[model samples]
Target: MSIAKRLASQTAIYGVSSIVGRVLNTLLVPVYTARFAAAEYGIVTGLYAYVAFLNVVFTYGMETTYFRFANRPDTDRRELYSRVMTLLLLSSALLTTVLALLARPLMSLLSLPPGHERYALWIALILGLDAVAAIPFARLRLENKARKFAAIRLANILLNVGLNLFFIVFCPDVLAGKYLAGLRPLVEGLYDPTIGVGYVFISNLAASAFTLLLLGRELLDFRPQLTLAPLRPLLQYAYPIMLMGLAGMVNETLDRILLPRWLPEGFYPGKSNLAAVGIYGACYKISILMSLVIQAFKYAAEPFFFGQSNDKNSPRTFALVLKWFTLCCAMLFVGVSVNVELVARVFLQRPEYLEGLAVVPVLLLANLFLGVYWNLSVWFKLTDKTYYGTYIGFAGAVLTVALNFLLIPLLGYMGSALATLACYFLMAALCWWLGERHFPVPYPVARLLAWLALAVGVVALSWWLPVAEGWPRYGLQALLTLGFVGLVGVVEGRRLRTI
Candidate 1:
């Protein structure tokens, strides 16, 4: 089979898990926003932002490191897996214990409410289970078990969503005497209305635990050997990658963490810190369409790239993938940006949470740049210059912090969104320039930029159009989206026919 076909197939399978899972996850946004006040939902958003950072810390780049060494000619795949698994298991256990013990202090440091220290415990357990399961999930990707990967992933999502519904919806009905009287006591015991967003965390923890159960075979398959021979090389490779992951998370999520705290004390006198956070967080999900696409591509691309590293035409292949990725991401950006109000209403569904709708376009464009940056990032990974990734990520993180700190106070979450856009645009440009100097991939920069330009132009035209909100506006946007697609097909069609 062709490399492109393989990657496409892998992407499709991964997309089933990522796209479906995230779409379902996104659906919960309305549920969350509807049930909790902006401030309450903000707590959920802030905690999860910390969760993203902690997840990176727990896994410590082992998944990528596993891919790096597993492809080496001299490495024993089984031993490497065992060593990596051993290292993660020990560290995850120790980290979980330490964090659980320090849960109260950590909660205080994070400026969470007075009595919610257990949030720390739940987050710690969730991250620990997920970290330990990381290698197993990556193993599925490495072995080309995409269907199994999707199945396990979807199962986890289904379980989590199911539990969330039961706790948040069904149990409440029962407790309120809207259902089974006999089960009222049990439902009352399980469902605490005051817990609010805590139910979301508990649901997630349950799902993570369930995923570990599903991955039992992968977990048990690895030997308990922890020798220094393989350990040294893996850690050496992973350390910088971990730093990169840390910085990347900072770039990705630190804004959500910082926004509430960074906003002026009386910025929203009527609202709590979480209220602004909740608003920014909800609007941020508006860009998940692009984010999920990038995530699915990354899931499939990482293993595919490593597997094809030794191929003679790998550079050309990477170039083609990058071009196509940019094209798709550009289309997504225009699609979401043009249909922003409809998308916002569908996902968020609450007027209050929609205050940050203006950030959607900025963030959509930011994620587009981010997707391109991910494509460019493969260069450093391929060249074993992983430290370059560390440098770029840290630089982006610095920009993120500085810009967000400056902007949030001035413009609220809009400033945060702009900061994100600036960080990613700079990162993508820097990576492209550096990639040319080190591992030239002949990225179709002009063609890619042309597509992006056209996408942005169409979106701009749609926005500036005087069509009133309703079917007329949607119809106009749809026509513009279709026009862009047709234009791409016409341009790329001629080139493909010649090939």
Candidate 2:
């Protein structure tokens, strides 16, 4: 098959799962902010932010390690799969056990409110399952079993959404009255209704555990081995990526972690700043469409590009792939930005939460640069110059932390958005600059800039146009979105057809 056809097939499997997964997850925004109070949803938001950071720590870059080693000429691919899977399984079991034992102190350490300790417990298990699940999923990717990979992902996510609806919507009131009338004694003893976000974690925990049942084939593929001969290079490659992944995650998620503490004091008793955090976070979901594309692209592109590293036409393919990736991502940015007011409403679910509409565009463009940087990063990955990636990612991480420290106190939630955008922009530039010397690809510099510039012009005019209350605003956004589509068709329509 042609490379384009291969990519198309892989992308379809990966993209459908991602789109479905995120869209399912987005339903939680309504479940959270509308059904539950915004302050309560903020706690949910903040906790998940920590989950994202911790997940990177637990997996510790093993996915990339699996890909790197499994493809090497001298390696026993089945043994490689078993080794990585065993490592993750052991680590996940140990981590979950440790957290469970220390749940009491850990809850107090994070300053959980009265009667919220179980919240810590449930999320820890969810993270554990997710960490272990990473191994089999990576194996699937290694085997090019994206269809099975997508199936597991979609199934797990859909189940979680289904259960969340049951608990938060259908069962809450009924169970609250019938079982809860008896349970309120226990509730008063150890639970809080406002902390209903715990049920969200509980639903995820069930789904995560259920996902494990489908990993049987991957686990039975080969016997586990721990000889130093094969393990050393994989760890060497993985350890640096762990640093890079950590730094990258901090850049992506530190804001969500910091916002609750960093906001100005004095308002509602339990949480005033939390509502603001939830509002910012809900708007963040609107940008999840960009995140979804990046995720699926990463899944398809990483192993694909890595396996192509030794191909004679690898650089040429990489260059072409990077160009197309940028154009598609930038068009997505334009699509979301042009119609953001409409998109924001779906996630926000409340009139007052509209304050976060401004950050949507900023976050969208930042993700565009992030996706571009990922494409450009094939240089470092293919050339075995990952130390440069470490440096770039670390620099971005530091920039993220420093910006949040300096600005969050001053500018509130908007500061977090700025920090993220700045960090990603710096990291992308550093990767490109360092990449050029080690392994240059003839990137379509002019075309990329042109697409970006066109997006800016269209978005600016769209924003400037009168978009008052009611359907007119939605109509204007729709028109702007269509204009972006029309422009894309003009520029790349012919090329797209040929591909």
Candidate 3:
């Protein structure tokens, strides 16, 4: 089969787990928005932002390191796997311990309720379980065990969703005498309304633990290594990646983290700073339509690129991947942006949450640039110049921080959205420039930009059109979205067919 076909197939398999599972997970947005006030949901948003950062710390870059070393001709795959797992296991335990110990301080730092230190503890456990499982999941990717990887991921998401529904929805309903009144005793044993948003973290912790258990076979042959000598080379390669991951998280999530803290009181009339965060966070879910594609592609592309690193035609193959990736994401950008109101209403159950809907398009485009950056980043990875990724990541993170600081007080969450877009665009552009110098890929930059521009133009036209709400607006959006897709087909049909 062709490389394009293989990547697409792998992406589809991964997407089933990522895209499908996230769609299931995204169901919780409406539930959460419906059940909790903006201030309450903000806690979920804020804590998870910290989780993104800590996850980078916990896993540290060993997954990619494992892939790199495992692919080396001189390396023993099993020993390498064992070493990676050993390091991850030990580090995750240490980090979890430290996090648990500092849970109270973290609660204060994160501005959580005074007594909710258990949230930090639950997050610590979740991170440790997930960090330890990283290599096993990466191994599945490396071995082309996409089905098993998807199965495990899907199981985790399903279980998380089930537990969330049980605790957040069903248990509460039973207690309220909505139904199943006799089961109130059983429900009472499981659910506490006072626990409230903490259940989100608990559900995730349970799912992560369940996932580690399901990965038992992958863990069976693990041999612990206390000394760092054998892992020096891997660590040397991985630490830079971990740094990049840290900076990347800052770029990706620090806006959410900083928005509430930095914004002035009464920035949005009646809304509090945390309420702005809740709005931004809920609206941010709309962009996951783009991120879902990016994530699945990343899962497949990382291993695919590494395995194909030596192929003479790999650059052209990489270029094609970016082209198709951009095309698909551009379509998504246009589709989601044009129908932002509909999408917002579906996921955000309150009128206040809709205030940030304007940020959705900016974020979708930002995520598209992010996907492009991921494709461009394959160059540094394949060349083992991963430190360049670190540099670019920090540059973007610095820009993100500076931009958020400058803009949040002025524009509120909209400032955060703009900062994200600018940051990702810079990262993608910088990566492409650097990749050209070190390891050039024949990326179709002009054509890709044209498609992006067209997508943006279509969305703008949708906004400018004096169409009334309801089926007319939606019908117009449908036509415009179709029109963009059709134009891409006309322009790229022959090229796509050749691929």
Candidate 4:
């Protein structure tokens, strides 16, 4: 089979888990917006922002490191897996213990109310379990066990979605003496009606624990072999990656984390800054169309890239992949940005949460650059110049923070969106420039920019040109989307046919 065909097949398998799972998870946005007020939802958003950062800390780049070492010619794959798994297990245990011990203090640090340390405790467990389970998950991907990988991931997401439905939808009825009167006491004992948003975190914790249990084969089948000999080299390789991952998280999530804190006190009447955070978070969900595609591509592409690194035509393969990836992302940007209003109307159950819809297009464009940046990052990983990636990530992090600080007070969450776009654009541009210098791939730069421009131009025309909102506007958007797709087909048709 051709490389493109193989990558597409792998991506489809991974997408069944990632895209479908995220779509299911996103279905809860209405439930969340319905059950929790904006401020309440903000708390959920804020805590999960920290969760993203800590996840990087807990896993500490082991997944990529595992792929790196495991794919090499001389490495003993089993021993390497065992060693990486052991290190992660130990670190996760230690981190969980520390967090459990200091949950109260950390909650206080996070500016939670006096009684909400349980959220911290739950988050700690969730991150710890997920961190350790990460290696086994990566192992499945490395061994081309995409079926098992998708199964486990889909299982976890389904469990989480189920629990979310039960707790948010049905538990209230039970607690209100509407159904299952006998279980009311049990439900009341475990659930507080006022803690509506907290249930999201709790549901996630249950899912994480269940996932660990499901991966028993990877964790329990073989006795763990402990050795420190490979430890030094792995850490040396991983440290820079850890920095890059952490910085990437900051670029990705700092806006969510800092929006509430940085906004002026009483920015909105009768609402805490959490409401602002909540609004931003809710609107951000609209951008997930792009994010989901990028994520699935990363899942499939990472191992594929590493596996093909030794091939004579690998650089050509990478270049072609980036070209196609850019085309897809551009189409995604146009599709989502053009129909955002419809998406908002359909998915946003609460009219009040629609206030932040303006940020969706901005963030969609931002995520396009992020996807491009990920494709460009193959150079650093292939050339062992991962430190360059670290520098780019930190630079983007700084840009994100600086822009957020400068703009949040003025533009609120819109400022955050703009900052993210700038950070990612800069990062992608820098990676491309550096990539050419160090490990050039014949990326079709002009064609990619042209595709991006066409997408943006269509989005601009649709957004700016006064079109009456009715079947007419819908018709225009559909045409615009189809036009972009047709343009890509025309430009890439011959190459695709050859493939």
Candidate achieving the largest TM-score: 3
**Which parts of model 3 have CA positions greater than 4 angstroms off?**
none
| Models, CA RMSD each | 1.6, 3.3, 1.0, 1.7
**Candidate 3 residue-wise lDDT, 384-421, digit = tens:** 99999999999999999999999999898989999999
| CA lDDT, candidate 1, residue 130 | 95
| lDDT (10s digit) by residue, model 4, range 120-162 | 8899999999998998899889989999889889999999999
Best by lDDT: 3
Expressed as tens digits, the lDDT of each residue in 258-335 for candidate 1 is 887799877866777778899888888878788999999999999998888899998998998988888878878887
What's the count of clashing pairs in each model shown? 0, 0, 0, 0
lDDT of 4 at 344: 86
lDDT (Cα) of model 4: 0.89
- Alpha-carbon error at 230 in model 2, in Å? 3.1
| Candidate 3 vs. true structure, TM-score | 0.98
Candidate models: Cα lDDT each: 0.88, 0.80, 0.91, 0.89
- For candidate 2, write residues 294-354 as lDDT tens digits: 8888888889998888888887788878878887887788878887776766777776567
Instruction: For model 3, give the 10-residue run with minimal summed lDDT.
Output: 220-229
Task: Tell me which residue pairs clash in candidate 2.
Answer: none
